[model samples]
Target chain A: MHEASIAASLIEIVIDTAEKNKAEKVTKVFVKIGRLAAIEIDSLEFAYDAIKEEYEIIKDSEIIIEDVPITGKCQKCGVTDTYEEMFFACGACGAFEVELLTGEELTITEIEVD
Target chain B: MGMVDVKAKILEKNYSKAAVLRDKFKNTCVLNFVSSPGSGKTSILEKVLVMFKDKYKLAVVEGDQQTTNDADRIEATGVTAYQVNTGRACHLEATDVEKAMAELGYDLDLLIIENVGNLVCPSQFDLGEDAKVIVLSTTEGDDKPIKYPVMFRVGSSFIINKTDLLPYVEFDVDKCIGYAKGVNPELEVFQASCKTGEGLEEIAAYIEGMIAKKKNA
Candidate 1:
């Protein structure tokens, strides 16, 4: 449901990037999403499929989603590591006092265009 | 096909607009509150309005799916409140706040934007607030911070509302605070019961202190 809006924003960014480069058609869009960004990739792709037809340049464009793992630093032991679980505790020190270093990102890194 | 390395934030439009709004509010304290439906957000704001009405020029931007009831309630407090009906949209975006700010004018000592109910969507959008406050009621369970981690992680403060009902409910205050702190190490937690007026003074003082700090900075 909210993914539609996210997809709309993404399409707008891709269009702007495509136009700025004077590309005739957009083939693919590379997007990086962090684990904590709270975006569902499948829903976003569905939204893009429904909305991309509105823009001719990106009608056939493919969205490539790259998942960014959650990485953080422990405040107690000063250890930095990546965790697949949502607990996000310091793996070495087992402390919950940790600062998130990354994995909150939602960015478009590149675009493939003709 | 040719590839263009146009590395940019997907929500750049919103980011840039939020940046502009942040600059505009550099001297003012803007607080955005997120909560589940019927978590006492409007009621809290009404009490807050009464507490600070005589001290500062306060403005509120109320976001709801429909109706101006919240705005009307705020207006009854003698403070201007802008009602933003998002229609089908689930959350309030930075653009919505920008328009609301335009309607309310820029001269304000404190601005509070009460986000639409729904912890999931509002967490994804940044409305250029100085701090995001998450309000939780005791009846809602203590695992909310861990279940809805995004909202807790983004929020700078957590308000445990409806504390007057604590004796009736099985809400562990310590566990709730611990869960929230685990999500956000620097999160400021406050316990308040709007019905009994408990903790409202402290909340008001905290906000006033924030406003003073921003103005002095």
Candidate 2:
């Protein structure tokens, strides 16, 4: 449901960026989504598609979503590892005091324009 | 076509608005309560309103998908509360809070935003609150923090509501605390029962202390 809001924001950013770059058409937009970002990629894509049609600059743009895995650094052992949300304990030390390094990101990395 | 490296966060607009709202709330201690539908949030809020009414000027922003039931409940306590109906949206945005706060006028020491009763989406959205307080009832089970780590992680405090029901329920307090600590080591845990007013004093005092500290600073 809130994916529509996110999509609308993405389109706003894309259009503003495209116009600032003096591009007439935006062909692609690259989005990075983390595993723990709690976003449904399919739903986000659907929302983007629904919203992009309203903006001429990004109407034909294709959104490329790249999923990033959750990565964390152990507080005690100083070991960084990729892990699942449920099994967030450090693989090396089995400590629960692991600090999240990634997998919470929701960013726009790049955009292609002509 | 040339590739433009537009490295930016998709939610920057909301974040920016939230930052502005945070600035507006810098002098006030704002607490956003997140919980499940039946976690006694409204009940606890009513008690808290009555408890702290004399100490500080307070206002509440109630976020719900529909109905002004919660706002009416708060107003019945004689506290000015604004209702932000988010329609199908699961959480209150900063803009919603800003509008409600403006309508509430500026003579308040504390602003409590009772977010829509959904833990998942509210955890992701920052409503310019100084602290995100999660309310968990003993009847909701103790594994909630572990099961919903995102909500637990974002919360600055966990209010274990309906504690008077502990004798009738199978909720293990220690286990719940341990699970919440596992997710958020810095979480301030409070045991409270809105029915008996068991730990409402401590909660009120803590919040009052926070407001005083903010005012002094």
The C-alpha lDDT values of all candidates are 0.89, 0.88
Span of ten consecutive residues with least summed lDDT in model 2 chain B: B119-128
> Candidate 2's residue-wise lDDT over B21-116, tens digit each?
878776888989999888999998898779878778899999999999999999999988999999988888888987997798656799999999
Cα RMSD of predicted structure 1: 1.4
The DockQ for candidate 1, computed on C-alphas, is 0.73
Question: What is the C-alpha lDDT profile of model 1 across B1-217, one tens digit per residue?
Answer: 7889977877788888889999999877899989998899988888877877888878999999999999999899888899999999999999999999888887888999999998888988888888998999989998898888888888988999999999999999999888787777788989999999988888888888888987998
- Tell me the spans in candidate 2 whose CA falls farther than 4 Å from its real position: B167-170
Query: What DockQ values do the models have?
Result: 0.73, 0.64
Location of the lowest summed lDDT over 10 successive residues in candidate 1 chain A: A82-91
For all predictions in the order shown, the interface RMSD in Å is 1.4, 1.8
lDDT of 1 by residue, A48-113 (tens): 899999999999999999988999999899999997765666899889888888899888889999
Predicted structure 2: lDDT: 0.88
Q: Lowest summed-lDDT stretch of 10 residues in model 1 chain B?
A: B177-186
